[model samples]
Target: MIEVRRFKKRFGSKEVHRGVSFHVEQGECLGLIGGSGSGKSVLLRSLIGLEKADSGSIVIEGQDITQMTERELIGIRKKVAYAFQGGALFDSMTVFDNLAYPLREHTDLKESDIKKKIRDLLFEFGLADSENLFPGSLSGGMQKRVGLARAIILNPDTILYDEPTAGLDPFNTRKISEMILRLKAKKKTGILVTHDMPVAFEVCDRIALLVHGNLDIIAKPKEIQQDALHPISIFAHGDIT
Candidate 1:
């Protein structure tokens, strides 16, 4: 559903993405794993036009987003939802309002329908009672669940996750992984950018290791595990000494 080819991005004298290329098929969750400063987040931003690439093509379902204008991108953004690392919930909005914001902005669904949708999502994410609470009142795990619930409330075809399990406890991390797996079962495409190796192995159908601004290896979890000498193995499992 998504294709990136020869993608290159730079920050002044520093280059972030150098000819990086990869694809995520429909119903597949591809994990993007990399060390610090590897530009994984920047690549995710570029997919949504939050960051412009210097030269390359990012095509989603046959449309090249690299050349799309802000107006043109509105439609694409609806089909591609991004779940930010820190939840990114509106501090001023209540949890219910935050969850309803996208539907109110993007769809003509009636207020009643919107409410139903929000309630269903909250229940699905195990947050049925959090609607009235503010983001600050929630725990880190609750906030992450709320962020994910908001991201999928619109039923976008593609979901881009940035550090979904960054600071959560093991239980919450497992919850996040289960959520990703649930999304995959429903045939949603996803690109998960995370440093959590266990989450990657548990949820992603394929894992792509980013090294030196490009995908050094893309393989299934078992393949990655079997190839001890592969760069991904080295990075994910450490030097097997």
Candidate 2:
């Protein structure tokens, strides 16, 4: 459902993405694993047109987003949702309002309908009681769940997750992992940018290792795990020897 070809991005003298390329098929979750400063998050932002690429194509369902105008991208944004790493919630808004914000802005649904949608999503994400709470009141894991809940509140065709399981305990990490798997079960297309290898292996149908601003390897979890001597595997395992 998403294809990136020969993508390149730069900031001043630094090149963030140098001819990076990858694809995520419909109903497939592709994990993008890379170290800090590898441009994984930037690539995710570029997918939804939040970060414009210097060159190359980012095609979603055959539309080249790189060439689209901001007005034109509004429709694409509805089809592709991004869940930010730090829960990016509006500190002033309650959780219900935060989840309802997208629907209220993007759809013509009535207030009652919007409330229903928010209630359902809260229940789905185990945030039913969190509707009245603010981001500061929640735990790290709860905040992450709320972030994810807001991302899918629109029922987008594709979801881009940036460090979904970051900074969470093992229990919460497992919950987030299971939530991702549940999304996969329902045939959701996703690109997961995470440093959590176990979560990546557990949830991704294919894993893409980004190295030196490019995709160094793209393979199934087992394929990657079995080749411990491979550069990507070694990097993932932190075994430089």
Candidate 3:
């Protein structure tokens, strides 16, 4: 459902994604793993159109989104959603309002319909009673769940996660990973960029290893384990592969 061809992104003199290329099928959970400064996050942002690539083509569904105008990108963006590392919830807004904001801005749904949608999402993400609470009042895990709810509010065809479980304890990490799987089961094409090896293996249908600004290898977890070229082996076993 997502195809990136020869994607190249740079920040001034530094190149982050050097001729990166990959494709994600519909309803597949693709894990992107890499060490710090490996350009994984930069590629994720570029994939989602948050950071325009210096040179490349990003096509989702069927449209080439890399060079689309902002007006054209709006409708395309509605078909994709991104969950940032920190949840990125508005501290000034309550959970209900936080969920409602996107619906209000993007759709013509009335307030009563938006209320019902928000309530349903709150319950779905296990935040039923916390609708009145602000994000600051929630735990780290709870905040992430809220972020997931918001990301799926529009029922996008693709979801991009940037370190979905970055700052949580182990229990919360598992919870987030399970949520990622569940979201994929619900038929949303998932692109999970995580540093956690166990979580990536547990949730991803396929894994892509990003190293030194290029896509080093892309395979299933078992295939990755068997392939000598897998960059994750170097990451997990210190060049022992």
Candidate 4:
């Protein structure tokens, strides 16, 4: 469902990715783990055209997004949803409005239909009562749930999660894991950028390690764990977070 080939990116004199490459099949979640400044989130953003690569290609379902213009990316963004690390909700808008904003802008669904969809999503994410609350008033976990709920409301074929369980407690983390599993059950494709190893191993079918500006290893979770000599397994137990 997704392929990134010979991807390279630079900011000023610093280059973050050099010939980085990977692929994700449909209905699979690939966990991205890396040391600080390895550009995991940058890779996620590049998929939806949030960060344009300097060279190479990012093809989603057959279309190369790296060659597309900003206007052309508007359509691409709908099929690929990004759940930002901090929820990225509007400070002033209520949760309902925050989730409704995308539907209203990109979809032709009526107000009644939008409300129904939002209500169902909130309920499924255990946030039925949060529809009327603002982002500031909710707990860290609830905000993440709302963000995930909003990201999936469009029923996008792919989801890019940037640290979805970064700051949550165990219960909340498990909740997020369960939610991700639910999405997997529905055959949703995803790329999860997370340093939370337990969650990564629990929810991801495969985990890849980003080192020295490239993906040095990609393997099943058990394979990663068994190879203690590998960079990924060595770094897995480190304080990368």
RMSD (Å) of each candidate, 1 decimal: 1.6, 1.4, 2.0, 1.4
**TM-score for all predictions?**
0.97, 0.96, 0.93, 0.96
In model 1, the runs with Cα more than 4 Å from the true position are 239-241
Give the local distance difference test score of model 2. Answer: 0.91
Writing each residue's lDDT as its tens digit, candidate 2 over 78-188 gives 999899998899999999999999999999999999999899888888888889998999998998899999898888889999999999999889888988889889899
Lowest summed-lDDT stretch of 10 residues in model 4? Answer: 232-241
Clashing pairs in 4: none
lDDT of each: 0.91, 0.91, 0.86, 0.91
For 13-97, candidate 3 gives per-residue lDDT tens digits of 9878899999999999999987787788888877767888889899998888898877888887788898988889999999999
lDDT of 4 by residue, 49-167 (tens): 99999999999989999999999998888889899888998989999999999999988999999999999889889999989999999999999989988898888999999999998
* Count of backbone collisions in candidate 4: 0
Error of 2 at 47 (Å): 0.4
Backbone clash pairs for candidate 2 read none
Off by over 4 Å in 2: none
C-alpha positional error of residue 122 in candidate 4 after TM-score superposition, expressed in Å: 0.6
Listed per model in order, the count of residue pairs whose N, CA or C atoms clash below 3 Å is 0, 0, 0, 0
